[model samples]
Target: MQIRDLPYADPGVADARSGPRFLLWLGRNQLGGQLKALAWGLLHFCGVAGLPLGVGRAVQAVVDRSGSALALAGALIILCGVAITLGDTMLHRTAVTNWITAAARVQQLLARKAAELGAALTRRVAAGEVVAVSTGDVEKIGWFVEALSRFAAAAITVVLVCVGLVLYVPELGVVVAVGVPVLALAVLPLLPRATRRADVQREKAGRATELASDTVAGLRVLRGIGGEELFLGRYRQASQEVRRAAVRSARMWALISAVQVLLPGLLLITVVWYGAGLAQDGRIEVGELVTVFSAVTLLMYPLRHFEEIAMAYSFSRPSAKRAARVLALRRTTEPSGVEYGRPSGDLYDPATGVLAPSGRFTAVVCGDPDAAGLLAERLGGHPAADPDGAASVLLGGVPLDELALDEARAAVLVQDKDPVLLSGTLQELLDVPSSGKVSAEDALKAAQCGDVLDALAQASVDTDGDGDGDPMRTRITERGRSLSGGQRQRLALARSLVTDPEVLVLDEPTSAVDSHTEARIAAGVKELRAGRTTVVFASSPLLLDRADRVVFVHDGDVAAVGVHRELLHGNAEYRAVVTRETEEEQLDGITAIGELAVLEEIEESA
Candidate 1:
């Protein structure tokens, strides 16, 4: 396939059995590109090998004073040059095409897996590793696949060159043949050590890359906490470690390169020394000596390809393994049957024994946020990891995981606490691919995003003071960094509401907002989702009071289920978790009042 028409309809199931298997799979995937590259590579090497024969014939013709033979040899040499030019150009083009296509295929596969796994992908693989695989690892894999054709062509040429020399002059040919193999094989012993060094360098580089990525992602937070210098120092140390590892790796590879060059040069010198002795004994012709010498000199070029191929394999093996790991991961839920599931009754999690009734707001109070996140994911039928043999969440007596992915997604929308707001216009962020049941205005109102809309409108480019600004036109910075925490949260809520799923699972949706804003949002959510199944995981009294029922999740299981008032009065565990937050707010209020009184006294003294 062409580069422009990339992102194959089916990237095809990867052969993740091993690193070598994965590299072979990538090669097989781009067979057409590889074949084209191979053909050109063969042509190029043929031109390279054919040159020595033509030069020998021309020299003999000159020595014999045969004008006709000289013209023929000159024509052959020119033809080889032309072939070399065309072959080299086309070979490079095809090789690059193979590289591009192979990389694209891997990227498509990784993207598909990312979509399937969502936030789980990052959890399963470190964010740095994923980043490295997608970028550097992908390129390395493509490089190896592309290099295979050239490596093959070079190897074949070396064999052919040695065979031709044997046919032309057996005495010299035997020595050349035996010596060439020795030169090639001698460097093989040092390769394992070099590869080990390379692996160490790669590992350090990946860690450094991950650290840099994390530091950049949390740059805003670092600045707020005045910890930029601390992170920078950490990164500096990481960068230095990577540098030292790279230097060690380079030194080993340099030694390998030195050996490869020195051995081949020694072989060339030995062949010339022996061939000169043969010529002196009248055993071989002058033309034959020239041809053998030129062939040995040219042979050095192809031998270098062997060194490159080894290096390529060493680097790409780890990369392919990482890519394969990502490709092999299966979504936690396996499709059970053909039928799509829609819960007509209560949404039940058998493991936790929590029932979120249909057509009502249910607030889940999980003592641990991690546990709550896991439960929320399970409820949505998209658990990040394996659910420990627990039965799939059931809705209306239908297994959630049994439904088609689309159907399951349509049925439940779980908004995690750390929701990302993609960089785009406000309209684009809300324009999610889903059933368009909820209007933008309705969702914004329900999300209590009036203040958010105003702030966005003020930041919008088209703020002409006409008083009827379209907040949708506002451009959100990456992850909505330009907006406050509460604004970003509200915007995320609005986007979720726009989807209007069957069961809306919100985890700490209004955590960043003030108590008053949280209360308004709590009421607005209840109003907007009047007859829909809404599950809110929270500990705030404002949100819990509005819930139709409150399920207290303590120590990993459902401990109590009742209305907000009943739970507050009856369950002490529930009361403490909820009231403790409120008590802190009251204490903050008292502190503020006392500070204001002190300021008033200071003003009176002045």
Candidate 2:
């Protein structure tokens, strides 16, 4: 395919059986492109090999003092030059196109795999390895793919040139033929060592990249804990190891390069030396000797491709293996080819015996924050930390794993306690694949963040003189770090509200906001999601009171199920987990609740 028409529609399913199989699969998919490149490469190398023959013919013509023969030989040389120019140009163009297209295809596959695995990808594979596969590994794989066809053409040209030399002057041709393979295969012995060094360098580099990624991701936390220097020192040591490994790899490759040059030089010397004896013995003409020497010299050029192909394969092999390993990871809730459409029943976790009734607001109170987080993820069909022990979440009497990935994601949306906001425009952030029932403006209002819109618009106006004061146009920094914690939390809540899924599971979504805003947000959510199934895993009284039903999960199972006030009065354990109030203070809760309401009203009015 052409470069402009790149990024194949499917990229097809990858063969993740092994690294070599994956590499072969990639090659098979691009056979058409490789053939085109190979054809052009053959023309180029043949044109180059034909040049020495043209020169030898012209020299013979000059010695004969024949004007017409000399003129013909000159024209032949010009024709060879034209062929070389045309063939070389097209060959390079096709080869580069092949390289770019192969890289694009691999990248598309990686992207598809990443989308399939989501956050689970990092848990299954190292983030740095994934990064390396998409970056350095992709280029190496493409390089090998592009180099293969050219190497094939070069090898063919070498064989043809050797046969031609043997036919023209069998005496020198025998030595040249024997010596050429020796030159090509001479570097084979050092390749294992070179490849091992390269692998070490690649491993070191991946570690360094992973360390840097982790450090950057937790930079704010690192600074808060005064551990920046510790991480920095660790990163520095990793970088030094990478540098040392790279140097060792480079040295081995340099040695191979030296051998490539030296062996070819020795072959050229031998061909010239042997041909000279033949010339002096009158067994070969002066012109024939020149032709043999020139042909052997040209043969060295194509033979270099052997070493290049070896180097390319060595580097790309590990990269392909790493990529294969990542792509091979399957989610625990992955589809089983069952057709499940539009889930419409209670969301139940059989493992925890917790049921979120259909079309009702349910709040789950878990004392352990980590357990609550795991429950939220499981509710959305994502496996918890201990996936093997956790049972599949069921919706509408169907296990989530039976549904397609798209269907499962659409049926349930989970907002983790620590939701991340990617860097983009405000519009882009809210532009999720959502049910059209809820509008962005309405969702923002329900999230109780109208002030966030105003702040965004004002920020836009300040940044750009010609701003139309559109909040949607405002660009958010990475992770929304430029905004306050409350603002980021509210915006994320607003985004989730926009989705308006069949079932929404929120884990302490308002933990960053104040009690006043949290109360308003709870009311807004209750009003907006009146008829939908929403599960909020939280302990706040405001949120729990708003729920149609409250489930108190003790240890790892459901302990009690009731309304917030009923649980507070009847279950002392539930009251302690929800409000952390002593028995004496509980008697005065009515007066405290009245005071809180009065303060909320005053805050609202102000």
lDDT of candidate 2 over 348-444, digit per residue (tens)? 9998999999999999999899889877878888762434667688898998877888888899998988889999999999999988999999999
Predict model 2's lDDT versus the native: 0.87
> Per-residue alpha-carbon lDDT of model 1 for 196-310, expressed as tens digits?
9888888888898888888887898999999999999999999999999989988988998899889888988998999899988989877788889888888888888899999
All models: lDDT?
0.85, 0.87
Strongest candidate by lDDT: 2
Tell me the TM-score of each prediction against the true structure.
0.91, 0.94
Q: Which pairs of residues collide in model 2? A: none
Cα misplacement distance, residue 553 of candidate 2 (Å):
2.6
